[model samples]
Target: GRPLTFPPGYNAAQAFIDRHLDEGRGDRAAILSRHGTVSYAELAARVSRCAHALTGRGVRPGDRLLMVVQDRPAFFYLFWGAIKAGIVPVPVNTMLRSRDYAVLIEDSGCGALAYSAEFAGEIEPALAERRPALVLRLDPAEEAALFEHGPDRFDPVPAGAERDCFWLYSSGSTGRPKGAVHLQRDMAVTSELYGVRTLGATAEDRFFSAARLFFAYGLGNAMTFPLWVGGTAVLLDERPTPASTFATIARFRPTLFFGVPTLYASQLEALDQDRPDLSSLRACVSAGEALPGDLLHRWRERTGLEILDGIGSTEALHIFISNRPGRTRGGSSGTLVPGYRARILDDTGAELPPGQPGRLWIQGESIASRYWRNPERTAAAMVGGWLDTGDTYLRDEDGHFYYCGRSDDMLKVGGIWCSPFEIESALIEHPAVREAAVIGRADGDGLIKPEAWLVLTESAVGDDALEQDLRLHCKARLAPYKFPRRFHFVADLPKTATGKIQRFRLRLGAEPAG
Candidate 1:
């Protein structure tokens, strides 16, 4: 595939708003909600009103607007409001606890915040603690009442394509989250490269994304792509558990679904008991972690649709490697998407041949320029315009990428480096183990030894024989050096809001006492 380019005047992305709402498919539903469906005209008008409201509250071009809301109509309004005023929209995860939210609020350095009233109390004290410039209460119900009189026509500010657009933070699974900054051009690049080329989305397609809008994956799939193609995007205002997710899919009958690996796995399990009418789901995408081959096979068997897996990060904005539908391999995170260049480089920065394990480096117009306000970390993370993904991967002979694990997550036992994924994947293969996390801890001899924390499939408590049997199973499949030295039965593993295993927490559990 050839490199892709964004359309001219992309920074003025909202400039096309009138065209979308007027000349284009105005009758189509732009957003579907349980309360009501919003047409293209309504969504555009609300966005314009929100922008007017922000301006009246002292926000201006080049300012930052922090949005912490669920997948409601107001979320899109606030997002476009920021764009309309030439301000950057920084979305904070609603699933974060109050303490985490406190840290995020401080880190974002946003002058103003426009958030749902539901979360106002949770963040109010935190806001008081930091005291941002302005706090605008965004009650959707209240706004709807006021929308009756608000101006119907407003103009968007002229912004250049290279202007700073928005900021997104990492999930901070390891520690404090890092805020990644992207240009306005990145949004158009994502739509052109992924939406137009990879997804083949059009105005008629309805998109349903399980990932939250606060997440990079969700932002790209749910908001940017649909808007770019003049398609409709279904926004679920609640947290997407398997049950609620399927119910929304059934009601909306979305043409495309985007989710994380864990979400897909849980959905597959739910289908086994009582299936939802998902026939309208033409394409599905997975990210946030490696899609297990077992889960992939089972999902296909159940849904009769292939789950296309991809690899992405907040720094890169969204997916870079994706198995585009028809040309997919069930296991591999397919070749690089258009408009991007990827290389597998060894420790010393030499390019590695195909099939060799190395750190994956990617360079593209879509890549975020730097982590917001953290020059030292940014310098360490990105080099020579390439974003160091920190993921160790190998490209097969066919140029498809396979995730090994994070570079820091690689365990060193004796002298050889081992990927925790190998052990975790093997552990999950056992019938009794439902989920597993593997980490290396210092043994009595000062050598690193692998330890496994497992969530059992059934009640196998007090079964010493079962533990020994699992150990033997690992011994048989893995080399002696690679097998876990100890196993601990756990009810569940610590996970972030995105359902990613908090591997750092697991490592902390294995630490020896002072």
Candidate 2:
């Protein structure tokens, strides 16, 4: 990876937002929502006003502000406003429960909390548990009235690139979410490497991401990447159902669409019933999970757009290995993006040969400094500034990386290591299986064996015949030991807020009823 360089007194908001205004792109559309379009100058003014409002309320530099807003223009204002004011903003997952919010509030030690009125039910309970000094509820009319009194020309605080600007809680599939502390330059590094170099985004592009604002994937897709290129970002406040997603595409007509594999599968099913106008999309990207080859082929066949699957995490900020526009492989996460270096190492930490599965370690400028207040975990994961991705993968002879599941998700069956991803991929290949997640379930003999939870397609039955067919399907396709010993029919696999399958929950025998 190339050395990252930034000038003195650099702030991400200044680079992504203020620079557009300074470069005479003030009139260009910065955000497009159902309400209306906001130009770069309009957004900057809103940010300035919001900053004034925050400072007037006693928010200062280095203060932490907890943001629980949905995907809307106000989210943009509050986020950049906090950054412009030199306050570290922690954008929490909007789908979290009250207890989850309480965890973040206590962990981040945020002095204030800003949330939309719709989330008052959850926020109030959390506040009751751990109240901050300031609580700002953003009711539309009241917030407008409050912002109107704010100064229009407030100077942004001079925070350098190295300053801690924000914290994103890790998606806690393994345990409670940990805050990943990110510097001001982290977003810029990812935007440059993945957004600019890989995706080839331009000012003419309009970006729409199904991932929400709180997650690292969403922050980059909908906000940072688009703003980095002076492009327009489409914001959606509602949950992204297949119907809603299709409608958003029809209405917004964004050029670059981002989503996870689960959403992609849903959209494909929706498209099968009614093909909508997706002509506006030039490219689409998938992350949060490995996209199966069968799903990719079906999507491309239906939509004429190949989904460029990638592997990314909260710790590394965004996608480090991704399939590019013209250089995409069906099932492989493409070569490492420019400005990032990746290595595959064995259990002993020695570099592994290509085509051998091992733990993945990535080094890049965008990697988080540490898991906030978690010195033990940070010391274990971050070795000499190289982030242990905690994922198992192999680099093919062609230099493309293939995801073999998470390190903890891999199972030892019959004295051989087997990746659950390989089995899940095979299971999804069956025509009846819409989605599949495999985990190592202990049998009566105290031996770990592969078990699968499957979500069948709409027309598929969940009777003995169907299960038998699926078993035979895997038996014919996978190794003998890789075949699932038992299959559980499920309506949906457990997933995180970011749409990642929660294998740990399944491993702990938490499978929902069929």
lDDT of each: 0.80, 0.89
For candidate 2, lDDT tens digit of each residue in 1-514?
A: 2245777988788887788878999999999989899999988888888888888889888889999998988889889988999989999998879998998899999988999899999999999888988899999775795455567666778888878989999886767678999999999899889988889888899999999989999999999998889999999989998888889999999999999999898888888788789999999999999999889999989999989999889999999999989778887988999888999999999999999999999999889999999999899999998999989999998899999999989998987889999999899888888899999877777777899899989998888888788889988998887888788888988898888898988877754322
What's the true lDDT of residue 85 in model 1?
75
RMSD of each: 2.5, 2.2
Summarize candidate 1's per-residue lDDT along 408-471 as a digit string, tens digits.
8888888987878877777777767777888888888788888888887654562778778878
Error of 2 at 283 (Å): 0.8
Off by over 4 Å in 2: 1-4, 510-514
* Superposition error at 484 for model 2 (Å): 1.6
Model 2 gets an lDDT of 0.89
